[model samples]
Target: MYADEICRMMVWSRGTAPATHDDAEHGSDPLTREWLVTNGLGGYASGTISGAVTRRFHGLLISALPAPLGRTMMLSDLSIRVVTPDGKVYQVGGQEPWLDETSAEVIDLAEFRLEAGLPVWRYEGAGMVFERRLLLPHGQNTVHVTYTLLEGAGPVRIELQPWVNFRPHEGALDRPVAGPYALTVVEDRYELASPSDLPPLRLQVQGARAEFRIESDRLRNVRYRIEQSRGYDAVGEFYSPGRFSLELPVSGSVTLVASTEAWETINALSTEEVQRAERKRRTRLLLAAAPEVRSGPPAELIFGADQFLITPAGRVEDAARARAGGDEVRTVIAGYHWFTDWGRDTMISLEGLTLVTGRHTEAGYILRTFAHYVKHGLIPNMFPEGKNDGLYHTADATLWFFHALDRYLTYTGDRETLRFILPTLTDIVEHHTRGTRFGIGVDPKDGLVRQGEEGYQLTWMDAKVGDYVVTPRRGKAVEINALWYNALRLMERWVRESEGDAASQRHGAAADRAKASFNQRFWSEEKGYLYDLIDGEQGTDDAFRPNQIFSISLPNPVLDPARWKGIVDQVKERLWTPVGLRSLAPGHPDYKPKYFGDLRARDLAYHQGTVWGWLMGPFVDAWLKVYPADLAGARSLLAGFPPHLDEACAGSISEIFDAEPPFTPRGCVAQAWSVAEVLRAYARTARSAG
Candidate 1:
């Protein structure tokens, strides 16, 4: 997911098809679709089932109503039953169900029923109604749905219906097509359509609402039309594949009918099918392992409205929906709620967004935006929404910003832009020298920077609860010092090329001084590891942490080869997980595995022992930096990344993972940093292989 404050629509096509108006109207067709159906407008969809039981699958599901306007309706009644190709009947799973602000609550929803022989489940609701049957032959199965709406609304209109199409691409799967049709709003109307003719699309309307006769006809190729009474507004469009145009009256209600043609098609494709397809394609190219590595299948998930995207700046609306909703075709076009002046996301999102998918412009924006925050020697932790507020929690975001800037310069070679930010970079170093938030002041004795104790999180694993610091190192963190060392080196290098001999000499001396002091103070021979942090008293914590990864992995190296190898081995044995690099080692007294539950339990596990996606960047980099450059070894090390990239999520990536075994992808499913890190790692590996 590319992280940038500004977002725009991107369209890509193969061959020269002579750019035509048809692309604008229908968005370049056979009308492929990838729908990310969630119950709510914002939050993530839930698909987890705890404990075992039977009855029917019941939950609050949400899909965009098949209308012209882009509006969604709640699926209050959702029940499904499963039966194998054999004669055995599988128990349905739906218990006490309730719709909350962002998810469905199912109480005892998975009880095993004693009765057998082709089980079926019935679903009834106020606005919409349906029934699902289970246990049919394996190859193809028919699904039936009955729909009805309330009275006194207006004419009912259905437009651009869904259809299935085939793709000729090597790995292309079946695709859903959005037909061009329109519906009128009306009261008490019956509508129906089907993928096959085995059973006539069934419709029954009987209630207190006004009733209208229905006229249904198959017209113009595969298109179908249903017209009812006229009164309410009728608006809708089939946006692409998985999306439909839908609009509803402020006061009226509408019933939706849903069924798929093939069971395999249903299982193969999701509302986010297009986005998933794109993810598979990109992951294949990015994964260092096989040419065929793909994400896992789409998991059936649903979310509600009222959820918001959480960022350092503040919560923003539908920031990740494009990716979650399956609209992410290229670089998961993810948005942030706020982009503080320091541009926290800008630099951080680069590895995931640009390098992974090769979206460099997005990378540039991240650097430029944060450079905007370098005011008076401070690169803001974030830029507050609709204000000039710049929060400075991170002592190294600015330093990392310089590293990213250097990278951007290497990629684009825009020396003018590089020169433009040089002054700001100098200001940031100067500010750290003076002093800032927490107690991030310079230590004159050793020349190593001293960061004070603060409540806010600075580095990526920053977790704080109320007044207690979760993983506070107090004085100076290992990674921050590593970044500081890199920053000085970057400045020295930049000064030589852009500012000539005198500037380089001045910065070079400072870099040497800082480098010597950093090595002397942070290296720990007794522990055979770098100290996690150094406080005002210069006390060191020898805990196994990920912070030291940067001391060896980053582009600029401050640690000797022996120390780098030791740190890498220690981290690998302690914090490494298949899903990601853990925030802290499991053996730490504070480590906890249960990451889901109430706020405190979750937060306690957050940075204490959780695995983070972004940390994979430094881990991979450090591993390669320390090991002898064996192409086979590097490829073998990177092989684990592809499955996570292609599994079920399609083009999107998760935020964090469980620190322990079965490291289920948890936290946000489509995090900016995760995408950025994956992209950067993929690019690094790909370039090496090339």
Candidate 2:
């Protein structure tokens, strides 16, 4: 049954065609459909299935370096060429220019699919077949690419040319770096060291004898079409130190190991051992999930969920501190191709990524870890890559922290962790009550939490371009107030449990006042739904957004119970899409159908009408709350994700999709909260179905 489900999750395609415009939205185009693998320490490898470098982030090794260095793109790419016994040359994987229609398809790629989150490709031509597989072992700054001659002529020579780069993962590809890249070879092991302060990148081959030829060359203007579309410097350059040539016999295989780790660490496991260990680890992860979600799309999402739960290796002190405390630092990488640990994303993703997956210890670790960073009642909005401290700019992340703690306790019953962070949690609530940074505080008269400040986008609808704050949901945003009310109630319950009734009464009273004010002030009597924001910069925003869903979706419903159906039904009619709920309703003046074009253009549409995949979690939660008997209907709402996993970042959910038809996936390819919410919702509905 597991094998059958694995086969089902596998997305495959035949032929070697350049990506068409439509292919970018769908998974059919190998050049646009990307795949990713991570090493648990924030290090990752990602590239398109067609093997072309479409984005600056497309690489074989993006090593997560210690403080100040962040994620460095060490090994950029590898050009693979196979020489047949008949002297026929074929390019299997290389820097193929996407726009070059004239480029010949030397390697006939017969198949490409992700086998249990590991990418596999098959090439067949002239009665010859070869298979390629790629994976990164857990918690190691390493990547292994193995090739096997499944059915090929004996003694066929294969050449490997590795491209080297010394830049941040988000660095401008076209920017030139001073590089006297010196190559040192000890037997088959090769190390490419640049003049930069960073460490050298190590490369080697296993299960095969290799010959190295010192042919130094620079490939210029390696165009990244995706970057160009996003209005950035698109062209890049790579330095190839040399080529490694090896001979492959029928049914013979060889593996290439690339890393920035020490030689001892690299040599700790053989290529097959690493592969076997990773496969077994993945299986164990799936088994750890709830029984109902151990197969099908949920099982595949369980794999996606693991990609974001990474150690903050860049913050070396965080690790040491955690170790000293007898705990490990675990945080969620909000999204791939470029996102660090975000407070909002992490808290939102906690239940689905950890609790449902049965990673209770890590869940506690995450909660406690964030608790260490709370400032003046606010959690850091995001920890910039390689930075020791996080930026405390968010208004609701801290509130979400309370909800995450509630979910963790509900799942594991680990009161010790609760007791440990309860003080910080109390401080957070007090801070919110009195008022904190970014003008965040509860209203004296109404008790509704209101947050807004100039030059800073506080809420989750935050999308800032230059001086402009898009969707600056300033005063008493629906979701923020809802989360605030929920947090107060949760605190009331926790305080009563730990410190007795007297301490808990304040929280209970505040929650009641907030709930009353929210129901009376925010609801649109004519529209029969909650307003997005009350007492905003302009006035009360009656813009029909999916944010109102949180009014009912949260653990504590802030909106009146009688109005739950009205809000849910309104969201269903206006904001809900197959993929997720749109940021804004279609008829709204700010509604933008598609999230595309340059940075400013995309950000404009970002919260205006873009469909956020993470919102699905809350939508589904609210759906089940409003329609408890229709578990099948809630399960069906998740049906879009299985097909979604096959596209964009294979085996993962994208950060956001287009609000319009086809809902072209935009923003980060693999999102943490996106995968988490979907997985959480799936598990809930599946259990209810049973």
Candidate 3:
């Protein structure tokens, strides 16, 4: 969608400036305020709004290991000191937190907000305004920090310090680079090439005479409280290559472009130019998805969604292999900070992130990218992290693929893309009916999909540690059966829409049998809600959970309207929250309200009662279908998210929230489906409103 066209479609979605959190105005905590900017290659630069590198993931240049796999944190931080005309020195942001306990209290920034997708800062004091801007251009492993004294009392002197390191995001820096580490000192720029195989790190302050101290200093015991809370390494030391001192005249701007690419490409374009381009890209996104939404989606949600979709630039191994299959894989990284693209997440997020957003090209590319990975009538549960082979432990990621495809076909009307994957889709039906991975196959007793095993965690409720399967819903899971029924019906329509189908008669029959069996087996008159799982090892675990909502939410629902009212009321009364649905109801014994502690403890609560933001999409879908007129109530559910953007990741949604009151946000700071679903629901409401 072009910007002009987007403007026409988007009744709102106007401002390009990021929502602001000005310390001078509001005085928020330094550690609590964080910002994120990603290069479309799956690499990102993130830190707090106060400019302190709090998390190990906080870095200026965390390069995508190759393209989109194992990510490595290259540049740790930049320590900036500003000098006024009167020689008054001020910290650009905050220094290492433990350097001085009082430093955070003293460090005060003027203003901070996101401009387009980039992070921009303004230091307003001493009768002057010094602006700092960060831009991570799409598809490039580069970080650009442009400093311009927007308004100054007089000529000011600025001294820049860069704390650089090369470590895996999970690991922390140990010591300074060996003396033998390659260093190229020049008049305008300085480059550090570590002894390790990591990319060469370079810093170029364009239009300034670079002066480096060339001292290898260690800043130790920098505390990462967020990591510490998660039972991970919370403190580490960073090796400062050196500190550079330079002067900027009043109204003069100089950009420090750091990249893995050659020094020339780093300065190829101006940050303002990059900023303009990014804003246009964002505008198109809002506009393209405008038709999906009513007054268009909020700028925060629209911009937040842009962070997940990236070019499928995976780790490339050999030149021959690269040539055989180009690294031009377009995909949506499941979440920021830790998640890679998972099959289930990718399919569930497709329509909202791509089709609804008017990224038809990206949508088609993503579908085809997954299409290439289908095996034995199964799509991978997740593309192996940092590896080529994909895991196929999941029983439903393949089935969800059909619904995603059907959605794409409806939105795009792209016959060629659908035709290409038709055989793969048909093969999935055959494979599921017969048998596939785990114990997943159609049960002859009911014709409903039944899946389970000793250790395999097949459904999204999957949270395993060693041999312990957390939610081991190892039977006729309600949602999986719902998806299976939906898939069968989808295949029937897929055949009818694409090819005048004689070979696909089984789809309709299969759908009918699954629906009848689903209603018979899943329905519970005693409970007044559908069973969470039927015929499991434990024999019909009729727990109240949000999972059964999907059965009534899908386009071709297996549940009748009478059943829909019961399920809807049950979910609303037991599981529903403002942001999302709780994994388990409060009445359930296993339900844990808070998500915290070590891995095992956290896993126990992961699905037990955590409120999932993504589940809101299905909840909204089910609500609208059941009521068909409570648009106000449906809209109110999503209205809670706009404020959520201001709280956690700043204009993005968290993967999950605590089930208890004040429901603290947790998990991936920026989640794909969380953002996608809200946008989709907003659009659905907007269309209804219009």
Candidate 4:
């Protein structure tokens, strides 16, 4: 067999650089100082300053709608400004209207102009703003603006405002979604007299402070209270959806309370007790802890929270419906539904949404939705939500499906369900073996699968533009081969366990044959590291990339200990980042440090060199598995995760970061895989330790 013919290679020797370069770089001046703030719910605000030029900036991005009682209305207004070191004030809105793109239509919220001493910009709409001056010397000053919620006649009375602020310092910060202003909400209620029937109820508010209050005429005798904790803050007033003002400093907590008649009503049904029970239930459904971090309460949990705060009746069903919308809110709730969604996120999310969150039916529906589009043995690259077509080019989706199906079976244990999808699995394997997209067909010469083209993104380093694929590996990729190995193993297992047909025995034999062939052709003796891929010329480049991590990290290990250790050492030396693992080595010819240029430029650099937050999952998994004997070392390696988790958005993980030092969080504010992998890894390590 090919596996038996392959020879094991010795570990590569490590090199040491002079200590001068390290010490010299350590004393560089600080680049800039930026900080983040948020509302307890989901909105975020950040401030940044460029130390080089001393330019100050502030930005706010809102992610939720405001609700009064149980109704929400369109966002009406927003405003923001900054006080300069020279005592000159710069108003944010007066220059250009801030555009809100969180929804389909972009609303221009900046409208006010400066009429006096300072360049003050004001935006007036359904929301109110208050101006207050502060005393400071020429070197430093403070400017404050407040937003007041306005009342309107709408059936539903609640408004969820999404906000974020960024101050990049030297240059202008990214425009705030709306006006850069503090948000606030106040509630007012009144009743109308009736001759013989029930009285009418109403709720209203004013101000924009990322805060709201709630009051009800029906519960006039009751009062609601707000509480703050180490990392959170809130203030309550009355309108609907129970209004409240909240400030969540990173790494803090806050709680809401209802008093008097409202308390009595809530207490009558043991609403607090019910809420506690629900929280516990939801937490258990989404909880996944690794050696370092945990990510859960999943999309369904957030949806449940939305329903809890909005409508009490049919809340679970309402959450399901809301998730189906697939908008940014739904996307965020889902924690990073990639634009190109094959099964990577869809399958991983199942663990949280279906297996853990108790929404198995939704899990089945989403799987079926994707399975319906499988073509030529290939799962989709992603589904076009607005269209009816799928981009079928992914190698891992089908493989992931087997795993997801297995997980779903473990949770639901419904043989009929498993049998229903068995054909899909079989078709995928058959398609790959026969022939598929790119050159990803089985090669009889070596039994190793072949894939990719000059400018086509086949494997996951898939950053591509119009006819120009960056980081194209037109050969056999490391991870794809690992996935291939896994697929064969899964097929053999499935066939033996479920189908039990004689043909399955043939499939098992073929799988065993392929695995042996993979080891012989892919392992590099000279470099002591597995080649990332084998080119058409049969030459392998011994680059230290993350793809090889899967071979060892996965439940099925394909490489022997010597080869696995060599790859791990190489990866740790080159690809590891304090925040996460970089996509490409910093020393690569195409490496770029700056990632904030035009969209096309940034996208090209995205996977080619950017450090993805989700890669940490496999990296952590591989590290822990390889270093299983070093329990303390494994835990120590993950210690950066909790602080990184806490430092980024509150309880949320960023999508990607710059590969170089001062690795700033980039891409989406919250990512699904980042949370999923972290939570899953954390849970696995924690379970093992326990």
lDDT of 2: 0.85
Kindly list the per-residue Cα lDDT of model 4 for residues 1-690, writing each as its tens digit: 111111111111112121232221111111122223222222222322110111121232222222211111111112233222233333322212232122222111232211111112222223222221111011111111223222212211222222222111111222322222222322332221122221121112222223443322111111101011111112211112333334322122222221112222323333234334434543443343111222222232232211111111112333455457441111113232113234566564555334444545555655555565578887666644223355766666566676677667766777775666678878888878887876777777766677865666766677776777766777777777777777677777777778676757866676677778778877878767777878643467566677778888765666666677777777888887766787777777777664544456766788766887667767766776677765565545445555443233323456677787677666544555665555454444554532
Considering TM-score, which of the candidate structures 1 and 3 is the better prediction for this target? 3
- Indicate the residue-level lDDT of 649 in model 2: 90
How do the residues 1-690 of candidate 2 rate in per-residue lDDT, one tens digit apiece? 332236433433444465565334334567788889998989899998778788888899999998899999988888777777777777774337432223534655667776777788887765678889888888888989898989965778988888877899999887775488888988778998988888989999998989988998887877778888788999888888888899999899988899999999999999999987887888788778888788878888888899999888867777787889999999999999899999999999999999999898999889888888888988899989888889999998998998999999898888999899989988988888899989999889899889988989998988999999988888889889999899989989989999999999999998889988888999888888888888998998888888888888898988888998877887888888888999999988889999888899989999999999999888888988889989999988877787787678988999999998888788899999999999988888976632
Root-mean-square deviation of Cα positions for candidate 4 versus the true structure, in angstroms? 16.7
Residue 249 in candidate 2, Cα distance off native in Å: 0.6
What is the per-residue lDDT of model 1 for residues 384-467, given as tens digits with 9 covering 90 to 100?
333335577776667778777777776678787777678888777777877766677677777677675657566655667787
lDDT (0 to 1) per candidate: 0.45, 0.85, 0.75, 0.44
C-alpha TM-scores of all predictions: 0.57, 0.97, 0.91, 0.58
lDDT of 3 at 596: 78
Residue 316, model 4: lDDT of 39
For each predicted model, how many residue pairs clash, with residues at least 3 apart or on different chains?
74, 0, 5, 82
Best by the lDDT measure: 2
TM-score, cand. 2: 0.97
What is the TM-score of candidate 4? 0.58
- Model 2 misplaced stretches (Cα beyond 4 Å): 1-5, 8-17, 21-27, 93-105
Name the top TM-score candidate.
2
Clash pairs, candidate 2, are none
